[model samples]
Target: MALATCATVAGGMADFLVARAMGRMGGGARLPPRVRDMCARLGRPLRERTFSCVLVLRLLPVGSAMMLSIAAGLAGARAAGFIAATLLGSLPQTVVFVLVGGGTEVNHQWQVALAVVLFVISGLGGVWLLRASRIARADRTT
Candidate 1:
């Protein structure tokens, strides 16, 4: 179990790093034209509140850091800025997951509670990001 936990955590970190790097490289440019067009249409709103929304989303585990990085990059934020913000915002929650996984289970309730909290937080962050993405796409159009 411990080994699995460690591997999972390490894999998560690696995936996040890979995503961030790819995002910085402009992953969005490779998107289908239709998707790009949609994003472009709603780019304006995202531009208006990109920083706050991105920061919050990055802090939540609902979205992966790499995915977030791609989003921020596609939204017109600087790659370095987005990467830095994502790292900072995600550190706490990522630590929580890693720490939790390091130990064995005593009671299932605690695990359930943690899962619930993470789910709630991630859900809220997702809504915020969705709104922000729409805004960002709109901004690009104008």
Candidate 2:
């Protein structure tokens, strides 16, 4: 458990550092004016709530870890805040997965059952999702 947590945090920090370096070096790219304006507007909120946003993103299994790290770095997040939020946020999912995967290969019945149940739930939920295109169409009609 401790080992898993440490490894996860270490990996996250490493990614964050590399992305941050890229962000620092890439700051001078000559983006178009319209795109640059949009980016500045969107990046404002991220800078304001760096820790909370990163922590929330970390908690979810969204699988865009590199992107988030890069964004955070680009947004000029403090190293301490990024690392702390990452450490705390990595706890729940890591522990759950470690526990689920800790079992021996021969006794994998429960793990399979749990995976199927979760998959079914997610599939069913996706069926009724309110898409952005639908919302935009409805708003335009109104």
Instruction: Name the top TM-score candidate.
Output: 2
Q: Write the per-residue lDDT of candidate 1 for residues 1-142, one digit (tens) a residue.
A: 3454455445435554554465468776777686566446535433466555556656556534454443444556544444455555555565456546643567555655675576567667656765755543444458
Weakest ten-residue segment in model 1 by summed lDDT: 63-72
Segments of candidate 1 deviating more than 4 angstroms: 1-29, 33-50, 60-64, 105-142
TM-score of each: 0.47, 0.62
Model 1 CA lDDT for position 82: 46
TM-score of 2: 0.62
- Residue 5's lDDT within candidate 1 is 42
Q: Could you tell me how far off, in angstroms, the CA of residue 122 lies in candidate 2 after the best superposition?
A: 14
RMSD of 1: 6.3
lDDT, each prediction: 0.54, 0.60
Estimate, for each residue in 24-64, the C-alpha lDDT of model 2 and write its tens digit: 78852454565444335435444665666666666555546
